[model samples]
Target: MEGAPPAKKMKTERQFDFSKCARRKVALMFAYLGWDYDGLVVQADSDNTIEEYIFHALEKTKLIESREACGWTRCGRTDKGVSAFRQVASLIVRSNLKEGPGVFWPEGTNAANWKETTQEIDFCQALNGVLPKEVRVLAWSVVPEDFSARFNCTQRVYKYFFARGQLNVDAMIAGSRLLIGEHDFRNFCRIDKNKARLETSYVRTIVNVTLEPSKWSCDTASGSSAYDMLELTVVGSSFLWHQIRCIVAVLLAIGSGRESPEVISQLLDINTHPRRPQYGMASETPLCLFDCSYDGVNLEWTWQPRALNATIVHLQKIWVDLQTKANMVRRMLGDLEELPGASGDSNGMTDYLYCGPPAKNYIPLLQRPTCDGLEDKREKRNAKQNGAPQTLLTESL
Candidate 1:
């Protein structure tokens, strides 16, 4: 038996026969509230990303066996805890549409008209059913075989939120105007200072940036009477990592008179220090992707409002209701009479000292107050006081 040549081992791996399938490219609109997730980009051995849930749904619905097999590509890599109203991804998959050959549906009852109905709105609903409550598919569209979400994108719009509290709205708006063109934003971004970073361009163009004030009101019957929530909306086509947050940090400093308005001009001038002051970035929870745009040739997708809009409204209502309850708890805590000699427990006392309603947030409002008198004097002093030139370029000498 040993001398006899061993029979060839039978192959155990299952070979998936995709050769008979006619592949078609499709683009899908993905929307998710990112507060509970890590971000949009997927990582190995990680389940806390919007992309992971998406691929899970895709596999659950038999869209693809794996992301790699589908040749999946995403338009943007949003940061941690950031939500998107509309983001895009493209992938290739076998098609059952009547327009393509080798059409096949999952094994079941055979319906000749199935291919015709695959491209309808019902497809969105069908996919959404498999997706989690936080993630939803807005629509799917058939695209040209060569279409790509990343390369074909003309612009990506990101919206950052800045809650208002004594914020110098005028100065922030003025500073935003200076950012409306192409410039090396290395100082504003958190780029990896390593040699391995290649091919990816960090110098993105800012087609436009707008800082507009927005208002929010909480329902009184829901145990809230505070109607004084103000915010700033900043829209930009493309942004570097933490770029928007860095800019907002400096502007908030300027608005509150912690820094001078002229600092903006100085930051813009690369001939000077060529670096910027270190400041904390804005909260990721407040950032949202409003929309993403691309050339018509790249895709032919229509916005399906019935489902997405309804979901958005429903979620917003839930959020508002929660906030109202929080406000109510805060008010009750504020009204509580402290027990005499409550041993260093200022607890409810601090809330009452702040007046009106109590707040659960230590820094709910981050904006700085405008200082007109001190700012005017500082401006005059700076103009009148002439000092030696300050330039890091010549500092070595």
Candidate 2:
């Protein structure tokens, strides 16, 4: 009996009867730390994305047969390393709710005893259990059969946070207002080759734009503005590839007095600047998809007791982890200050520009600095099209 290979255990996780499950249209609200992912969408080159984990959980839970069958549509395809607080996705999923004359009717009129018979699927509990700690399924809602997360979304909110170096906060605010209406933003975003193939327009409308101090800043007047975190909030119908980051880059330049606020106007004018200026975008580490809005959809989010407890524990652990590192750094700096001549301030000549400033020989942006634009891309493409041998295109991060 000992040599009989121990009577193999049945694999319950992978093998499931999906055909017997009832399907319903649902939308899931998610929050995730995207630093560990290759962005939200599943790509051919990588399987480590947030979407991959969601689908894996769905499969494991026997929620659906395949990703395609779910008719899944995401509200926004956030960039890599960009976090999200209110990401939403619509899909067809397996449900255990009962339908009848009045209860769970197409018209949404529920019977008195409908609540007693119908039961909601524990989507968050199931997915959170299987998903990595960086990602979490916040809640799920029963949506209409015709609901679409992408098209039905009324607006999207994006927030980018950064330290306000020597930049002008008021000037950045003034420049942000110039983006409030519809405009051809070719200069504010990189072209998406796939979308461009269909002759898509670069025109998009900005509903609102504002820059304010984040909670990280101390209220005291003596607090260092260079270390104070500022938040750029943008609300729009839709956005282009790297649009938010490009805009942030421009604002940073404006704040630094390198460019006037009118530069935004000049760049937006098609006749003035058809091609985008060459400039590095803001870092992706502090960018986030803050929220997505839907009109007329009353999403009732239900949290199970066990799942709620698990979420509390998970979040507390993250806080503690950060707190420990912060405390260690604080203590280390205090100890260093106690050393000889270590507590003294820097000399007036050794001023720190935070991010923009550098050592004595550092070139400023006001100087004639080179930047890549559409013309550069056009020339390369033309050369290749004209029978000139070209290597595969590669780019740095």
Candidate 3:
């Protein structure tokens, strides 16, 4: 006994049980930094996604028994490195609500009893406390049992920000205005049957699209003094894969004067130019899922003043570090600009990145290179299935 190791005291983790608590179908609003996430959905390969982290916090807080049992429905499946400000999801969660002398109320009882809860769970604080700083549970709502976050969502708003880079903001604004109203956006979006079985319709309504200067535009030092960050906000009933990015890419091309503003009209007329021309998409880092609108859901938020302050402080630290690095780059760029024969007016200020080629290289839209359009795709598929000759890209064009 004397030589034996001291009697080990077994350690226990704090456990919160929800077996008897009233459960309700609730929708939670989330905001996250997408730069580090592999998107909002949970996948087999990585637990680093926003959904994975959120579910982890939910489990730790004893809010749900399992992800499968929660009836999870995400509003959108944003691609990797895409951020969300008001992303929403519906799921069954443990509630502090009480009912008429029932601990585990009848299993088939009405799911709308979430309102009976005496006090709403302080989800923002509880989940934010456990989740990584990049992901935050902003608010939660008591939604209808029939609610489906994906199906019920009415509209989605997106914002993209970029420097002007000698861009024609007025022309960009004009180009965006052409996107208003319902149109078959097939030319604006690539055909992807996997993302949507309804690609045959290829139609979406754009409620509004506007370009405006960001708040920091008044700050002269912002963005190398050429232009501050300008944002393009688009509201739509729904969007296809890379749709917004593709639209933004075209707008940028027009802004750079490589393409005429009338090109938007030409692109919108699917009857004329059935295929999309070759072009690059805009960067993803500046695109954000600004909000998703639903008709009935009204989220009630609980603030964590103390925790929020700490978060603000952390953000300031990050901003400061980034500002330092940015200043160094700015100084280095200034030094390079002053180098002999490196006049700031290099190449007579010809465009570099956004444009495709020299002004002469810009051929008429009718003759420009084209990708497979609807008809061409159908031909290829039929050919592939029927052992017929596949349509060539040149023939399709």
CA RMSD (A), model 3: 4.7
Clash count of each predicted structure: 0, 0, 1
Off by over 4 Å in 1: 1-22, 100-121, 194-201, 215-227, 296-298, 302-317, 326-397
Higher-ranked by TM-score: 1 or 3: 3
Tens-digit per-residue lDDT, 1-397, candidate 3:
7789898888998665444567777788888879878888899998878899988998988888788888999888887888888888888887676642212343755445444546656767788889887777766767777789999999999988776656778998998999999887877776753423433677889999989888754335433534356778999978987788789878877887767788888899998877888665666667899999986656554445765666666567766887788678767766787789875642322243233444545655446678777766776666786999875764421
When summed lDDT is taken over every stretch of 10 residues in candidate 3, the lowest stretch is 346-355
Q: How many clashes show up in model 2?
A: 0
Q: Residue-wise lDDT of candidate 1 within 144-174, one digit each (tens)? A: 7677888777788777654444456678777
Error of 3 at 321 (Å): 3.2
Model 2 — which ten-residue stretch has the worst lDDT?
346-355
Best TM-score among the predictions, by candidate number: 3
RMSD of 2: 5.7
- Compute each candidate's TM-score over C-alphas: 0.68, 0.79, 0.82
Badly placed stretches (over 4 Å) of model 2 are 1-14, 100-117, 195-198, 216-222, 303-306, 330-397
Please write out the lDDT profile of model 2 over residues 1-397, one tens digit for every residue: 6667677778775565444445678888888889778899999999989999899999877777798867999999987888998899988776666552111333323333233436667888988989999888887777887788999998999998776656688998999999999998877887643424225677899999999999654324334344456789999999988899889878876886667888888778866665555556666778899999998877666656787788778977987997688568656755665689774332221132122343355344334333434444555566666988754443312
